[model samples]
Target: MSRGFTLLELLITILVIGALMVWAVPSYSSVSEKIKMERLAKELSGFVLMAKSEAVMRRERLWIHIVMSGATNSSGDWSLELTDRDTQGVGNRLLHLSGKPFDGITLSNTYTSDQISFDETHGRPKSGRISFHPINASTDLLEMRTYHRSAIVRVCSPNSALYLNYERC
Candidate 1:
């Protein structure tokens, strides 16, 4: 009896494995991208909530500055920098958050100003949406929204086809 597989059988197995890999690789890459976006969204939402709470607890306003990078001013890595709105001489940095390198995620927001601020009285922020997605792909968008009357930040997906378990925006 043969101890090992024949040449034909080995070739067939190799072909099948290659086919499966071809089918799975792209899906895996896509899922990974979505996951990255989701993670950033969640983190952003949490930070916004933290800023709101800190604003109320400290009885002071807070500003989250959005900094963008890249040549065209729209594609590359971005970060959130938290600071007190009342500080002078740029010495009151509280928190800073940035994504992992090479993720190629870009940030866009609907804020009327470059910064998102929380009120000291009620911790309510100006209504706006902050979004994170891949550099050139919009299908994997994840958004964090703040309402004018609520301190809670909501994370959701605008594109429902990405198969993320988050609520729809």
Candidate 2:
């Protein structure tokens, strides 16, 4: 008799592998989406901190413009551009991060007023004294939904306080 596996054993092995994949694929995808969302949030926070520091050091009006555009199918690109405008009335002395979107993520809410422009001297934009969310009196939500995946980043501004709420959608 052959020492190798019989036909029956081979079929069973294939079926077991298929079953394992059916259970693992969805979980893996979910985890991946979560990781992407977290990474984007961290990047945004870092950029904000960097802009603030630069403004303070240079003593100039450094602006961090957060722009989001595109749809879920188009792989939307949102970027943070840092520009320094001095008292001389010059516009955009420096261009930082020219609108780069996160990997595996498409941006939505283009008209959702998600732009958060902040200057070192003025702190945040005209919306309120705080940057992020929960500062503006409007009920407008700055929500960033991940691509084909199931994840969302809801930004709310209340009482000049910015809050980011991350949840699986």
Candidate 3:
């Protein structure tokens, strides 16, 4: 016989490769979503920290805004801005951190209150929570039909006493 794989051996090898692909594909997709969620959370945290730092360093009230809007699997839009001196004044666009990583992700604030302001004196936040949901589906317990994805990343600042990484938020 020639020094070549037999038909039976080749078939078995192909079967094995196919089986592995079947198992790997779904896992890869789920893991990708998880990674996206983690990355978005980190970016948001960094943005918050940056605001805190700027406010402290400049020693002036720094008001910032973040806007997130996306309906479905469509990529969402998030832009950061610097508000005029007046607390409720219109914000001038500072930077738009391309939210492509979080395109299909849903970002909603649990508190939905203040426009995130850091005091020049202490660099403290107004105390709130921002929740990231991968899909628009709702969770079982919350039952609000707002959050769908089980994988979530939450940025929480329970009180104004929060001092970035230095203190509990």
- Provide the TM-score for each candidate, comma-separated: 0.76, 0.57, 0.62
Tens digits of per-residue lDDT, candidate 1, 1-169, equal 7598899999999999999999999899877776777677768888988888888998988888776653213344666777896332264778887755426676778876457888999899878888777776877677888888756678888878343667787
List the global CA lDDT of all models.
0.75, 0.46, 0.55
- Rank all candidate structures by their lDDT, best first, as comma-separated numbers: 1, 3, 2
Best-fitting candidate, measured by TM-score? 1
Residue range 45-124, candidate 2, lDDT tens digits: 55655655666566665654545443332243556567664322247645554333444454343322333344445343
lDDT per residue for candidate 3 within 102-145, as digits (tens), equals 77666655434335666777666665555555564323011011
Candidate with more favorable, higher TM-score: 1 or 3:
1
Better of 2 and 3 by TM-score: 3
Which residue pairs in candidate 1 have backbone atoms (N, alpha carbon, C) closer than 3 angstroms, thus clashing? none
Q: In model 1, which runs have C-alpha deviations exceeding 4 angstroms?
A: 1-16, 70-76, 86-89, 135-137, 159-163
RMSD of each: 3.6, 9.8, 8.6
